[model samples]
Target: MPVIVVEVMPKPELLDPQGKAVAGALHRLGISDISGVRIGKRFEVTVDEVTDAVLAEVTKLADDMFSNSVIEDVVSISVHPAPASA
Candidate 1:
Protein backbone atom coordinates (compact mmCIF):
# COMPACT_ATOMS: atom_id res chain seq x y z
CA MET A 1 0.00 0.00 0.00
CA PRO A 2 0.93 3.60 -0.53
CA VAL A 3 0.19 6.60 1.64
CA ILE A 4 -1.11 9.94 0.47
CA VAL A 5 -0.63 13.01 2.60
CA VAL A 6 -2.88 15.99 2.06
CA GLU A 7 -2.41 19.33 3.78
CA VAL A 8 -5.30 21.76 3.40
CA MET A 9 -5.48 25.32 4.65
CA PRO A 10 -7.15 28.64 4.09
CA LYS A 11 -5.82 31.09 1.54
CA PRO A 12 -3.62 33.91 2.77
CA GLU A 13 -6.47 36.41 2.65
CA LEU A 14 -9.04 34.16 4.31
CA LEU A 15 -10.03 34.22 7.98
CA ASP A 16 -9.43 31.25 10.24
CA PRO A 17 -11.87 31.19 13.13
CA GLN A 18 -10.46 28.16 14.88
CA GLY A 19 -6.96 29.57 14.74
CA LYS A 20 -8.16 32.90 16.08
CA ALA A 21 -9.90 31.20 19.00
CA VAL A 22 -6.77 29.29 19.91
CA ALA A 23 -4.72 32.45 19.69
CA GLY A 24 -7.12 34.20 21.98
CA ALA A 25 -6.85 31.42 24.53
CA LEU A 26 -3.08 31.55 24.30
CA HIS A 27 -3.14 35.27 24.89
CA ARG A 28 -5.29 34.83 28.01
CA LEU A 29 -2.78 32.23 29.18
CA GLY A 30 -0.06 34.91 29.14
CA ILE A 31 1.28 34.27 25.66
CA SER A 32 0.21 37.61 24.27
CA ASP A 33 2.99 37.77 21.71
CA ILE A 34 1.62 34.99 19.55
CA SER A 35 -0.02 36.11 16.33
CA GLY A 36 -1.10 34.98 12.88
CA VAL A 37 -2.18 31.54 13.94
CA ARG A 38 -3.77 29.55 11.12
CA ILE A 39 -5.54 26.22 11.35
CA GLY A 40 -5.48 23.56 8.65
CA LYS A 41 -6.35 19.93 7.95
CA ARG A 42 -4.06 16.99 7.29
CA PHE A 43 -5.24 13.74 5.77
CA GLU A 44 -3.36 10.48 5.39
CA VAL A 45 -4.83 8.00 2.92
CA THR A 46 -3.76 4.43 2.37
CA VAL A 47 -4.14 3.19 -1.19
CA ASP A 48 -2.92 0.39 -3.35
CA GLU A 49 -1.00 2.61 -5.72
CA VAL A 50 0.64 6.01 -6.11
CA THR A 51 0.46 6.77 -9.79
CA ASP A 52 -0.33 10.07 -11.48
CA ALA A 53 -3.83 8.93 -12.38
CA VAL A 54 -4.50 7.84 -8.82
CA LEU A 55 -3.12 11.06 -7.43
CA ALA A 56 -5.28 13.06 -9.82
CA GLU A 57 -8.37 11.21 -8.65
CA VAL A 58 -7.43 11.77 -5.04
CA THR A 59 -6.89 15.46 -5.75
CA LYS A 60 -10.36 15.71 -7.17
CA LEU A 61 -11.72 13.98 -4.09
CA ALA A 62 -9.83 16.41 -1.88
CA ASP A 63 -11.25 19.36 -3.77
CA ASP A 64 -14.77 18.02 -3.49
CA MET A 65 -14.84 16.31 -0.10
CA PHE A 66 -12.02 17.77 1.99
CA SER A 67 -11.65 21.37 0.98
CA ASN A 68 -13.40 24.43 -0.42
CA SER A 69 -11.32 26.05 -3.14
CA VAL A 70 -12.95 29.43 -2.66
CA ILE A 71 -11.18 30.04 0.62
CA GLU A 72 -8.87 27.07 1.03
CA ASP A 73 -5.57 25.90 -0.44
CA VAL A 74 -3.70 22.68 -0.73
CA VAL A 75 -0.18 22.91 0.66
CA SER A 76 1.08 19.59 -0.55
CA ILE A 77 0.14 16.23 -2.03
CA SER A 78 2.73 13.62 -1.23
CA VAL A 79 2.75 9.89 -1.88
CA HIS A 80 4.94 7.53 0.09
CA PRO A 81 5.61 3.94 -0.75
CA ALA A 82 4.60 1.29 1.74
CA PRO A 83 7.14 -0.19 4.10
CA ALA A 84 8.75 -3.50 3.25
CA SER A 85 8.41 -6.65 5.28
CA ALA A 86 10.18 -6.57 8.61
Candidate 2:
Protein backbone atom coordinates (compact mmCIF):
# COMPACT_ATOMS: atom_id res chain seq x y z
CA MET A 1 0.00 0.00 0.00
CA PRO A 2 1.04 3.54 -0.65
CA VAL A 3 -0.09 6.65 1.17
CA ILE A 4 -0.74 9.99 -0.45
CA VAL A 5 -0.91 13.24 1.46
CA VAL A 6 -2.56 16.27 -0.06
CA GLU A 7 -2.28 19.77 1.37
CA VAL A 8 -4.61 22.50 0.17
CA MET A 9 -4.45 26.18 1.11
CA PRO A 10 -5.69 29.56 0.04
CA LYS A 11 -3.61 31.63 -2.29
CA PRO A 12 -1.52 34.38 -0.76
CA GLU A 13 -3.44 37.03 -2.66
CA LEU A 14 -6.75 35.89 -1.31
CA LEU A 15 -8.19 36.68 2.09
CA ASP A 16 -9.03 33.83 4.44
CA PRO A 17 -11.85 34.84 6.76
CA GLN A 18 -12.01 31.49 8.50
CA GLY A 19 -8.33 31.64 9.22
CA LYS A 20 -8.67 35.12 10.64
CA ALA A 21 -11.51 34.00 12.87
CA VAL A 22 -9.45 31.12 14.18
CA ALA A 23 -6.53 33.39 14.79
CA GLY A 24 -8.68 35.83 16.69
CA ALA A 25 -10.05 33.04 18.80
CA LEU A 26 -6.58 31.82 19.54
CA HIS A 27 -5.58 35.31 20.59
CA ARG A 28 -8.57 35.57 22.90
CA LEU A 29 -7.44 32.34 24.48
CA GLY A 30 -4.19 34.03 25.55
CA ILE A 31 -2.08 32.80 22.61
CA SER A 32 -1.29 36.23 21.20
CA ASP A 33 2.26 35.51 20.12
CA ILE A 34 1.15 33.72 16.96
CA SER A 35 0.73 35.71 13.78
CA GLY A 36 0.34 35.26 10.04
CA VAL A 37 -2.19 32.51 10.63
CA ARG A 38 -3.65 30.71 7.67
CA ILE A 39 -5.95 27.73 7.46
CA GLY A 40 -5.57 24.72 5.17
CA LYS A 41 -6.80 21.19 4.67
CA ARG A 42 -5.00 17.87 4.49
CA PHE A 43 -6.12 14.66 2.86
CA GLU A 44 -4.59 11.21 3.17
CA VAL A 45 -5.19 8.48 0.61
CA THR A 46 -4.18 4.86 0.76
CA VAL A 47 -3.77 2.95 -2.47
CA ASP A 48 -2.28 -0.33 -3.61
CA GLU A 49 0.31 1.36 -5.77
CA VAL A 50 1.31 5.00 -6.08
CA THR A 51 4.03 6.25 -8.37
CA ASP A 52 5.13 9.61 -9.66
CA ALA A 53 2.81 9.23 -12.63
CA VAL A 54 -0.08 8.45 -10.30
CA LEU A 55 0.75 11.46 -8.16
CA ALA A 56 0.77 13.72 -11.19
CA GLU A 57 -2.55 12.36 -12.32
CA VAL A 58 -4.09 12.81 -8.91
CA THR A 59 -2.69 16.33 -8.62
CA LYS A 60 -4.23 17.25 -11.94
CA LEU A 61 -7.52 15.79 -10.86
CA ALA A 62 -7.46 17.74 -7.65
CA ASP A 63 -6.55 20.97 -9.39
CA ASP A 64 -9.23 20.57 -12.03
CA MET A 65 -12.04 18.90 -10.13
CA PHE A 66 -11.57 19.54 -6.43
CA SER A 67 -9.47 22.66 -5.78
CA ASN A 68 -10.39 26.18 -6.84
CA SER A 69 -7.30 27.82 -8.22
CA VAL A 70 -8.72 31.31 -7.80
CA ILE A 71 -8.79 30.98 -4.02
CA GLU A 72 -7.06 27.70 -3.18
CA ASP A 73 -3.57 26.38 -3.81
CA VAL A 74 -2.27 22.86 -3.82
CA VAL A 75 0.69 22.96 -1.52
CA SER A 76 2.14 19.46 -1.78
CA ILE A 77 1.55 15.87 -2.82
CA SER A 78 3.62 13.27 -1.02
CA VAL A 79 3.62 9.53 -1.63
CA HIS A 80 5.09 6.94 0.72
CA PRO A 81 5.27 3.25 0.01
CA ALA A 82 4.18 0.61 2.46
CA PRO A 83 6.67 -1.30 4.55
CA ALA A 84 7.85 -4.68 3.29
CA SER A 85 7.36 -7.87 5.18
CA ALA A 86 10.31 -9.23 7.14
Model 1: CA > 4 A from native: none
Tens digits of per-residue lDDT, candidate 1, 1-86, equal 88999999999787799999898889889996787588999999888888888899999988888888998988888887888861
Off by over 4 Å in 2: none
Q: How many collisions between residues are there in candidate 2?
A: 0
Look at candidate 2 and tell me the lDDT of residue 1: 76
lDDT of each: 0.87, 0.82
Per-residue lDDT of candidate 2, residues 7-80 (tens digit): 88999788999889998999899996898589888878777688777887788877886678888998988887
Candidate 1 weakest ten by summed lDDT: 77-86
